[model samples]
Target: MAPISIRNNPDRLRYEVLDGDLAIGQAAYVDDGEGRRIFYHTVIDEDYGGQGLAGRLAAQALDETVAAGLMIVPVCPYIKNYLGKHTQYADNIQKPTPALLTVLNNALARRTRR
Candidate 1:
């Protein structure tokens, strides 16, 4: 299998698959006063679902966020679950707040659009 490529699109706050030419996963975030607060809403296309693409994307996103020194707010159910299983990323997780939830919801809406 070809290696997966994750590219961060700052304009859309999403990390996409460059090799597959497919948007295998994405995360949403908002610029808070301190830093970017990421909320992952990742989805692997059905054809790619079982291949560990989502995890890879999420891991890359977390890695990038850490590199940038940004905190995260994992509002996406998948992300929440994934993080629950991956304690190593806990330090990067930001505590969720009402405002952050609003931001996450809005970002998700934008992502659903064409």
Candidate 2:
């Protein structure tokens, strides 16, 4: 397997992972001055799914956000659940509004059902 590489594609508004020559996963976000309010998605190629690549991608994205002095709005369910399990990241979390939480939940549900 090729080592995981996390890259920031400002034009795409997200961080992505390249596993060897393959694009294994991505964490999309939106940047507002207050912080990088992350949302929408993460998808690991089926071949890479069981290797914890998604978590690694999330960790890298979080690290980048912190390095940039930005907080996180984990509008993406993977991120919310990650923060839930990894309380250490709570410091960077920007509290979510109910509507936002609803949207995240819905996205998660949709993804899960697929």
TM-score of each: 0.78, 0.76
Tens-digit per-residue lDDT, 3-114, candidate 2: 8888877766778889766667788876654454655677777876788878888888888888888878876788888878888877878877776666556655665697
Model 1 CA deviation exceeding 4 Å by range: 1-3, 105-114
Q: Write the per-residue lDDT of candidate 1 for residues 30-84, one digit (tens) a residue.
A: 6554676656567766766687777887788888888888887777787888889
True-structure RMSD, every candidate? 2.9, 5.6
lDDT of 2 at 3: 80
The window of 10 residues in a row where model 2 has the poorest summed lDDT is 31-40
Would you list the C-alpha lDDT of every candidate in the order shown? 0.74, 0.75
Best by TM-score: 1
